[model samples]
Target: MAEDLAREEPRFPPAEADVLVPLVPARREGGAHRVRFGLAYLALAAVAGAALGTTVVVLDRPGKTAGPEWSSWQPSGDRDAHPRQIADHVSQRYRRPSGTQLVAVTYAGEPQVQQVPLSAVAIQTGGDGSDSPPKFVQIENGLMYNLCGLGPSCAFPEGELSEGGLQLLRREALELALYSFKYAGADSVIALLPPNVGNQQDPDDDTSRTLFFQKRDLARELERPLRTTLLAPEQPQPAEIDPDEGLIIDRLTQPRLFQYEIRQAQEGSAFLILAPLVGG
Candidate 1:
């Protein structure tokens, strides 16, 4: 009976059918998933690259620049040797851009200049101690007044008049005073020889004590004082004069020594006052 049933059914064991699993469909699904993951990773990489590129572009631009530079220039030739020529040069160049100029002067190695408008005046004065009191004066932006005085005659041990006294006075004056120029008008300036008096000594005594006066400080004392009533106002009531004119200017033009007088005897004392030269 078993043989007959086996022949009629042509049957295999159920275990063989179970053994034929759907391997191809599972492999296809796994491959599809892997492809999707790869594409996602590529998209993420592209996004990161784009973000980095944007960051790099924003960090490149421009900023601030520099300022104006002044070239080293000497005055019209050596006209600096003469105060009057310097004044004229300053007058001619006395404007900026449309109408201002810068005038500079140097003593030893220190240099000073001013920015003045047209019509301002620049002045420079020089003399022996005999013409003006030896003094040092400086103004912020206006006129400077100066005085020079000559040395007194002196007798040497030989009972003869010695030129050494004059020479000493000249040296003292040269060391004591300075020529200063300041703006006097919109287009002009005035030169000044400031007094540098060290003291009032007897003409006969070579060893007398000298009293010194700093012209610049004295001018300031006249304008503004410290602690004491040493300064006296100008007399003759110059008629409620606008102090500004005497104390102000567009700017201060430094003094230049055009010519120097070694020993003229008329002891001179020049006083300088600076005032604004603009605004009515």
Candidate 2:
């Protein structure tokens, strides 16, 4: 039986030879194509990642973008100069329309005399002494009897001034504060206008009407031509004033006044005492 089976030809169902295809050849071809596609995808991803990394590096660089408008006024002269020196520079350069110099009072109560009686006190904040860079600058100026029309010879009565006159006085004080902010790198400015004539006589007098200004608030004006911003109107009228300008004027004209005292606990240890003036 073994010999008969070996000699007999295998009889099975007949099929077309063309229809019998090997799976290995098809699989090998598909796998090769998939590997090529994967390599191309990885190459593209690498390029995209490089581009994004470059963008981030460019953006991270300093001064690549513009700063705020108010920051355009860069500090000039000796970069390492003391704050007091900077204050002195600002005072010397400042000029009024009448071509008169502004009086500058230092922290130690020493006065730098000028042609005009108008005074400016630059108070440095957040520092051990005048040598350090100030965090903020407080500029105090007086509205003298002559300026306020309060003297016997003036048209206005004592302690009285027209709305226009008051606004003019505030504008002068604000301009000085702006100069300090621009030249001294002050972040904020406190423009203190003490009661008309009394505080002028006494340097330590606490009675004051204050107008606060942040660098951001006057950014637009500072960006414009300095002459235009400082231009004195022939006759300033309330009706013709811009709304933004009006807001600042309104704040200056507020009834309330701020009072503060300077007390020195010991030599080289000075402090301030602040409170709202009652019925001011």
Candidate 3:
């Protein structure tokens, strides 16, 4: 029976084989058992490779990086952060102390950026009873005057301006003088005479004295303009004195002195590339 089986199975000759193997078991299941696990593993590997390829394709799509615009662009620094930048521009034009205070302006709500150029800012002085001349001054219209105290002795009659009166006026005038100007030119100075008092000099003629603010000959030596105001015990004769703003030429014979303060908003400065203001 073994020889018959061997003959039917076609066994290899012993001289030709180190170990005789049978093909019967392999052929019994049509080779399915031999390759079943390998085929399953190959299918799994193909599925995994397809998933990885899909992920790579999705990541390589266009229009993927659209970040915020501001992420790359930064805002400027605070407008007031660099006061010296403005001061340096002013210093080039005017003789000034290093201690000059700079008033910076910016967008109302924003503190980190300048709304205007450094030259556009103006400086105002404080009337602290001191004779230090104001740093920033303006010549708008024709007159150059500051506000007066609302007291009874606000006006000074012409006759009462004696040597003592002149002394007092001079003290006040020092405060109002514009020593260091940023926006005005030396030639822009003008004189404004006090208003004539009702054209009468009668007894009890309680009228405000005529005061004048004269421009100095800055070409010779820079002189501060005269600053005058009246201090009386009663209401002003006109009831209210409007601020005079225009150029007026008159004598400052009995010049009076007054103190004044300069504020930033009240003044303006500019780094003008000044050509002729108008065309030919």
Candidate 4:
């Protein structure tokens, strides 16, 4: 499944900026390069099966970014019957083009895919609001993207993308959605991260920008040391923001994301990755 989610996550590196408080710049443009955020109404598909192994087929395609814009994102589902007659993990529902809901729920179905060794490259600052300096233009294979417009009234459609091209698509779509939360069995996965990953939340609430996720012990070896927020002391927070837990960041646009909901917890069910901002 994408080489088992890139061998269980730990590949952070795409410019890394993580700005916490340095805002006040919201622009509005009509989908030229496109920027709706909320994955523009959903339609993800995945396929792989020789004799019943990886048969992911979440329905929905024809979005944007020229038909292929995924620096990195994991989450797919589609099941009606036959895949070895389905075993576990089910709550399937897929039909949210404008709402009415029908994405039952299937995490352990078709995720855990990674192919960002480096190909969809594109780096160039001054996206289009040119003042002078802010250039890093580089699109090796080309087909790059940067759509952001949600969360705390976010935005980022001035020229296309800058801030390292939406930090390599929000750090490969938030660690490939936390490396598919133990095969999406659910039990905590919250993310809204962007702004080049690190410190952001100033007039945005939900307990300092919701991202209470946890999952890092496949063997434990990944290190970056910036996280330190269990929350206490009447927590007002923001003394140098940039210590995230699962994922939560958005300078503007690219927060057009989704994924969450699954109650029942004594010590389980907490998949709440937040980032819904890309509508009408």
Please list the C-alpha lDDT of all candidates, in the order they appear.
0.29, 0.43, 0.28, 0.28
The alpha-carbon lDDT assigned to residue 13 of candidate 2 equals 53
- TM-score of model 3 vs. true structure: 0.21
Give one digit per residue, the lDDT tens place, for model 3 in 170-259: 222222222212122212222111222222344354423322232452222222222222222211112122223111111122222221
Ranking of all candidate structures by their TM-score, best first: 2, 1, 3, 4
Worst 10 residues of 1 by lDDT: 180-189
Enumerate clash totals for all models, in the order shown.
71, 0, 30, 38
Error of 3 at 75 (Å): 29
- Candidate 1's residue-wise lDDT over 1-280, tens digit each? 3342222222333544446655566777778988997997787777767765655555443456643322122234342343433344323432222232211222221111232211221222233333443433332233211222222221122222223222222222222222222111111122322222211233333331111223443344233322122111221112222344223211111122222222212333222222211111
Q: What TM-score, computed on C-alpha atoms, does each candidate reach?
A: 0.24, 0.35, 0.21, 0.18
Top candidate (TM-score): 2
Q: Candidate 1, after superposition: displacement of residue 183 in Å?
A: 22
Tens-digit lDDT string for candidate 4 (1-280): 4453322222334654885643754445534324543343232111113212322222222345553322122334642222212211111111122332211222222211132222111122332444544222221211111222332234322333333333333433333233333234433333333232222222222121212233432113113211222111121112322444213344222433332222232343222223333310
Per-residue error at 151 for model 4, in Å? 21
The 10 consecutive residues of candidate 2 with the worst lDDT sum are 141-150
Off by over 4 Å in 3: 1-143, 147-150, 156-163, 178-203, 214-218, 223-280
Error of 1 at 128 (Å): 28
Question: Residue 49 in candidate 3 has what lDDT?
Answer: 72
Q: Judged by TM-score relative to the true structure, which candidate is superior, 1 or 2?
A: 2
